[model samples]
Target: MSNKRGKGPMGFGGPMGGAVHGGAKAKDFKGSSKKLLNYLKPYRLSIIIVLIFAIGSAAFSIIGPKILGKATTKLFEGLVSKVSGTAGAGIDFEYIGRIIIILAVLYLISALFSFIQGYIMSGIAQKVSYNLRKEISIKINKLPLKYFDKLTHGEVLSRVTNDVDTVSNTLNQSLSQIFTSFTTLIGVLIMMLSISVSMTLVSVLILPLSAILISFVVKKSQRYFKEQQNFLGHVNGHVEEIYGGHNIMKAFNGEEKAVKEFNELNETLYNSAWKSQFLSGMMMPIMSFIGNIGYVLVSILGGYLAVKKTIEVGDIQSFIQYIRSFTQPISQAAQIANVLQSTAAATERVFEFLEEEEESDNLSTPVDINEIKGSVEFKNVHFGYNEDKIIINDFSSKIKPGQRIAIVGPTGAGKTTIVKLLMRFYELNSGEILLDNTNITSFKRSDLRKVFGMVLQDTWLFNGSIMDNIRYGRLDATDEEVLEAAKAAHVDHFIKTLPDGYNMELNEDASNVSQGQKQLLTIARAILADPKILILDEATSSVDTRTEVLIQKAMDNLMNGRTSFIIAHRLSTIKDADLILVMKDGDIIEQGNHKELLEKKGFYASLYNSQFENSEAS
Candidate 1:
């Protein structure tokens, strides 16, 4: 019952942040990236098409400045000739018009290519996200209950929502940016060199300074980004916990504590977020200043070259444009690096969940559930949530078919653990549980579980109509059958009294109904299941004494000719049980008929007497 397992992969605060400003580095960047890329293998041809489109877009855009430079040179030549009173003295508007048309076509093509690639990439990203969410949903069912014991609901939800979105966004936006940036960088550099090597050298000289400054800022900001992501997850988790238990917090006067905790987490997140954003904000200005210096140098050099007629005036214009284009990609590449880190972190968490050890079904040919009898036995079972600390030791018991058995004990006496072991929720460290003298492991877990119906202390109902919630016990059950089960559980009158009868919808937490109603609904579900073996763990504890008596009668009718195991703290409830199992310190201290145990004046008798005294006092 003491689940002391270590935190699962998603248990560190929660999932990492989704944005570039709050990107966290992966523990195994290369490994995680490799795994992530594997998901894209199915769309390899689409990705290739995206790459081609992206490159074409960048290439076409990069060629525009150089071509426009030709028009500038032509215009300058005609103006100079006109100033000199030459034969060709006027500007050639026709030539300039033709160049304008070419430039317009080029830019239009570039935009079209960009749009097409973006459209394709968006689809790919969404499909990948869909696949990931689907896998996570399926994995939730496949995971053992112990896995959930080590993780919070928020942590698991974060992976399915936030982490997967991060990967998807990165794939959609950043991926195409990467292709375009590199292509632009290369094409712009080549054009710059072709225009004027001397100016190109001067322009390229500023890059080292830009790189050094960008690197310094990135190095300083990386830790803050990581911290931002960490704190973001903590804030999210805290908010989820507080919101989910709003009523409990109010009842306990915990609003101040909750607010204080939120403020602390929010403060940390604000600090990290601003610091990372400020540092990242510095990159563009720094690059621009460095680029301005390059521009100044290029301009002065181009003027000298132009004075000497070494290079055309338009070439200088083109070279300056190329220098500006070149620095843009460098800035983009730097940002993309951080984005990649975030993507890797997100993908790593998703992959970790997907790769978690699923519950193994070792039975190749499982025993049929229909062949199983109601007889149950536990033989010398030794088990623990954590192997080093055993909770159930040398515990053994047997129940004949149709026997009404009650397991009574103080809290943590391993009473619940016995039922958990019987259902194979957690594998026993040693010993075997038998269903009609056959080892339980011989049956598939799904098939074995079909033989039992459980109505526990905690009732669970999803957001649905009362009819749907009840019919969850047997998915194929018709409305008539569901109504029959509800009546049998004594919940029919309650349902009919409501506004919509069984059609009334439960809210997200099913809070519209009272505690007793929820319990009745669960009982209704179990009755609809009509399982051969039944487990009632404090099943009627929520209802009032009058309702409890009514439910008891209904349960008695339902339990007739069925094997039933009842675990209860109210000893008076089980006075007529055919057998009472008294558990103490993970072992059965005494077990016999209720009257026989009371006559013995031992542990069971004392437990029953104490409960009886408490009832009398109340």
Candidate 2:
């Protein structure tokens, strides 16, 4: 259905609408609707059955007006006969009672069919929603990290929540409504025409005016509805960003700025919402005006036809009832078309997300994790986040099993990118990384990742008990094992100080614990994993100076025989490394033991001196 003819009686084009909200706009109604129909194909049998019941219900209800007219006609004839003093002057109470009973039975049947159709349609709608959401959840795991880097968390979440809700709600309420309205309209039209074509003409004449009014209101309101949806996404994004970064924002005195930004987005959403609602609300009143006019004309024409003996009194009454029934369905059908357009808009977003390219899992002969040694070699690697710019150009490194390596570099010197590449978190532009004489790409991603344990500068802890968080590193680990791992990480003492010990529940924001405590907990998690290789990216950066000494001792014990790579800003922490690699820009400028680099008086020597000099100055 086209937008012009598809608007709801409220002038709203879809399930919900507002003005000038930013985001994706509704696409071509016909194209989106066609795609949405594909999802319904699986439920075609149930949908057909629902439609049959809906039609049966509407047909039964349509028959009532005709039967009711008989009661009215019989009463009128009896009154006239009594006045004329004729035989059979009194009312035929038995016949009138029978007609009333038949009308009641027809209405009861109609109601029952309506209920059945609704019940079945509700099931179909819920199933479709469940399936769509499940596909989206699975799709999230397949998407590359770059996709997330480009889209905000709230934007992706909105597609799953708001957009899916819109589609589900429309299907549940509007789909069967459309079927019933269409059947009722057709049945009423036929009945009205059978009574008197002249009275039917009066009713038909008002349809053009209704069409014009509905078309105009829909065109004006649809744009606002699309805007409202977009603004809603923006509002959600703003709120998510602020909430996640609440601490940073407060530390930098950014609360006011965040509030201001939120208010701007909120205001835009409000404007679009109210305007769309106002315009849509106009549709019902306009439709009613036209309907009333049609009713007046139908009544006048029916009275004229009766006087001319062109139609019976009861038939005229039935025609009037049919007119009332006919107009209601006509309006409902028009509104349903608008609802369908809105549903298509929502369904398209879901399909678009599902259609995104997934990471390839084509390595059928993946190396087993148990077979991998701690040895790693990067052979003339080339990489970049984007194709046009090279960030890690001609990089090469080799580390043997049980070796300790430290990577030291200024910001933006590709220090982290090297670790990312080694883990195969990103695909290489050229060259390869190998572990235990086998290329990393020769193993499944899961198997390759299992061989390494990482403790990053930023500690992440979910809302769970301390024991639960530690066990996250290895799901099958026992409580005793978890406690042992915490002891090995030197975090057991602090954990024991808590009233609930390991059983304490963390709040949603996990703000109850200090930063140093969170860092220690993450270290405990890595200890539990007991991976073949360990990567520490400033793992103790958040700890106090006293705690740092203990953590360093714990990490040294943990890395006793494992190939370990440490990336640290504190030059003192890596002074005992087996080898230190100093990077500048995207290239390694100096690589050797700390003493060898200091004696060489090269880039590493200068960098090491600068840090201490800055600390002493401060």
Candidate 3:
């Protein structure tokens, strides 16, 4: 099944869509922010302690300069007094050195604590990301097949890789930076007030303008941020389509069309990316300009105050340095605000999947089929992929234990759909399908699928050893059992000649293996299961005529004691069936054995004769 086919054909307008009971989720950035904070609740104490250390670290870093300034001013004051003879003045250089050494010790303690806090916070962030990834992966497994039926492989992968990565980085980088910025701002403001409350007032006159600029930039950046994520989704969807259908494009001579379509999508992606980055990039410059204007105002104002002897020169100098520290952190904090918004958008998408409702099943236990009787019955079965497009209407059938049933149909006939219903992939809209007099709906889905083994036209294999691929049918099957199944499928001889024999690693999508070989492996897997109900869906379509003959013999042996349902276009292959059903337009129009259907001289007879003549001609 290709992932790009969203929701399935039943989605009507969309290709391969899934159940769309709910529309797109409506989530706000505020909600995402709250959820992220909740994830940190377990480490609140550590977070607070880290914050305290961060404040102390920045404060101590600022203290060295203040202490040096005070000591220098006192030394100069004593020199002036000594020269003017106003009083006997003495300054102790020793005491100044001791004070400087004490300040150094304080800064060292702060640095040590800062390092420890950084390591612990980062550890918490990484742990959170790891837990989230594991939780999402487990949730994905529990999701119903219908959910996967609608979503593309690349879109889901983006949720895992892109969304999770964004969230992880925000926790590790933005959250911590936010803490440091706020603390630095508060600490610097307090120091400024202590130095001169009046001067502090003058310095922050430009702050309102800075705040407004930051808010405007952030508000505008929000839309572009959202558009960027949406465009990224489109890009991922496009890439998945192109890669999966590269061969199809070449076959249809659509390479130029594909390139043009892809380029248009890429261009939209580029525009969105530029808009998002451009808006964020403006934050630094706008804030920088405002801070510089504030600095100039404070410098000129402080000089006036100093000349009037209202504040000391050293105090004005210290005040300006504090303002510098404060502005840098304030501007950085604004940028963190913008980054967090973008991260929240991604978080919202991720949690939307987490919150999605999956299909529900009430059956707790199923009849274990150690030996299935293979009696299948469709009792007044009514089914449809959608309400508007009914595939089977009042369909009924009964297959006696160990009987062989052949279903013949045109392209839109419900033959293949019958098999899907029999397996209970999609529940019938208003009827029951019974197996050996028991309703299949009463059985667990896993147990129901286990009763049958299938070989389909599309041959799929994993990137593992041949033994592992075959052993997928019955996980407990041993090496000898696998080899036996392969032998029965007429694939063992080829496997033995390959490099490393059955241990050879398959390549991407098993592309290195031949199409016939891939089909043989799936058939071997089905054989290893030794199921009660066997379905061969054009099983030998890819093989040459010689291999087809061999495969038919192998399939006959495999289906000897099982109830078999075969869907094939090749009419000659089903001549020995006990019951032959010819269907058209979702309804069975003709029936009976080969000889009886020929006598009816109806749709079945014409189809049989035409195919008979084609065989004769060949």
Candidate 4:
């Protein structure tokens, strides 16, 4: 039952594997950042308000130290006068009290503005994240299945979850920080210069050193940040793949191999994560060291100026406070720079996925599905998953409105590919597939798919009640219709044996039921659809012999008046088919009814005989 062809190795050149190794630098920081800003366009007014609030908050905080210096000067002068026995020049508690009150009010106003800006920014960030996730969800549906084949589930899920979260968090925390940090830096610089120009010059002398150090760290860290993001996706993909195939892995004694692969991926992630974090972490301490040197130089110079009466003692205190404020935002800006780089990396991956080539759009004037009969025709159809390797070359077939056509062939003989082509899962290279004399291209993909139902060897059942799972075939179906469909698939009796009957809940992986039961539920879903055309690809392969017989009977009833295409490995099950297509190497070697094919003693006869011998031998 080899329904799918074998895929090649997922090498470094593959879509998901391209960034596995290190040295994956951020490709388009400016471009990705610009695109990310577009998401904020709708919230422009709110953002402006946030900026204003942030700036106001920082400005008020910056003014506090200068005003507090006034109280320091007044107390100092009072102490000197009292020590000199000057009664009239004694300290004024009234002035000190007024300064304290004003200081408290200023700080309070700053805190309020800060709170308001944070609240507004959070809302904007969340809305942007919501829009990104919504777009990703819609983009997924528009993407072709082939695009998915080149990537892993975890890789895609990583972009949807981790990448978007990275962008959201940065927007929420960093956007306002930018405004406040810039404001604090400029405001503090002005205050420092107003106190004494010489001290200001001495204090700013360390600027070039801080700038050079920040540049070095950012340059060294950007590539590792990009690599960290890439390996995070790989690690996620590896975990998901291993978890989904846990049973198979254990059965085949593949635990060692799985662990080994995980360790390699985890090791890469570890290396990138630590390197990026360490470089970013170095910024604060390095800046602090440089800031401390400036602090020493400013303190000595301020004392000398005060002794010479060039600046007041209170002015010296205010200048020191300004120096601290100045260096803090520089460090903050440095940290923010690193954060922005990481965000850019994440944003790039997200935009890449959103910009992927989508499936061809629906035709403007689509043929109505209601007018289509079950009749299907493949006219000299040519197709290949890859263009250079033709899987189905010059194949032609015509099916009547109410015929049972069985397609049988050895593994990789293009049996499943035929049905995929008919369903428009993949387009043809140089031919057309027609439904009731009209090209399938004339119909919208949704409309075309609505006319047919498919049950594959791989059963898919989401976590839900049995009744709900069946109703998934047709969302508007009534409970009675679902029950009838279950009965037709011979699964009603099994459902009734459960404690909750049809209402039992399946787990995330639907592991509560046996494999055969899962297959039966999928069959029931197909029956519930009640489509005009049917495709069954080894649909009964998982069931026991007894269950297969019951299901075959149910299938006979369901396919009574519908056009059905059955791809089977066991020739015995399809012996009564109205037409049999025997294929080899993407070409139809023979075609006819079972009796006629047996008389010819060609490919079909050989296949039937081999299966019969294998059954007897077993």
Q: Name the best candidate (by lDDT).
A: 1
Give the Cα RMSD of candidate 4: 5.4
lDDT of 1 by residue, 1-618 (tens): 111111222211211122344555789999999998888999999999999999999999999999999999999999999999998579999999999999999999999999999999999999999999999999999999999999878679878987898899889988988898889988998888888888888887888888999889878977887777677767766776777778899999999988888888789879987887787777768877898898889999999999999999899888888888988878766667777887898899999999999989987688888966699998999998998999898988889999999998999999989988888888989998999999999988899899999999999999999999999999999999999999999999989999998899999989999988899899999999999999999998788888889779889988998999999988888988999999988989899998889899999888878888888898
Give the alpha-carbon lDDT of every model: 0.87, 0.82, 0.76, 0.84
Pairs that clash in candidate 4: none
RMSD of each: 3.7, 4.7, 6.7, 5.4
Least well predicted 10-residue stretch by lDDT in candidate 3:
9-18
Which candidate do you rate higher for lDDT, 1 or 3?
Answer: 1
Number of the predicted model whose TM-score against the real structure is largest:
1
- The residue pairs in collision within model 3 are 5-16, 6-16, 6-17, 7-16, 7-17, 7-18, 7-150, 8-16, 8-17, 18-150
Model 2 Cα displacement at 443 (Å)?
0.3
lDDT of 4 by residue, 261-380 (tens): 889888997998888777766776787889889888988998898889898778878888898888777766655665676678889989999999888955778888996679998899
The 10 consecutive residues of candidate 1 with the worst lDDT sum are 7-16
Q: How many Å off is the CA of 610 in candidate 1?
A: 1.3
- The residue-by-residue lDDT of candidate 2 on 89-149, one tens digit each, is 7899999999988988999999999999999999998998899899899999888776787
Against the true structure, what is each candidate's TM-score?
0.94, 0.91, 0.84, 0.91
Per-residue lDDT of candidate 3, residues 1-618 (tens digit): 121322211000111110111112225978987877787799788788777777677777767556665765667666767778875566767777887788779779868867876887788878877877887897787676557778767568767776777677767766767776777788778888877788788777778888888778766765665555555556666667777788887899888877787788678868866775676677678867887787788878888987897766667667777877887776665556555665777688788888877545666575766656999988788877776888887878889988888998878788888998898777688888989989987777777889999999998898899999999999999999999999999899989999988999998699888888898899999999999999988888798888889788889999998999988888788889888888887777887888899899999888878988988999
What clash pairs does model 2 have?
6-338, 10-280, 17-225, 18-224, 18-225, 18-272, 19-272, 21-227
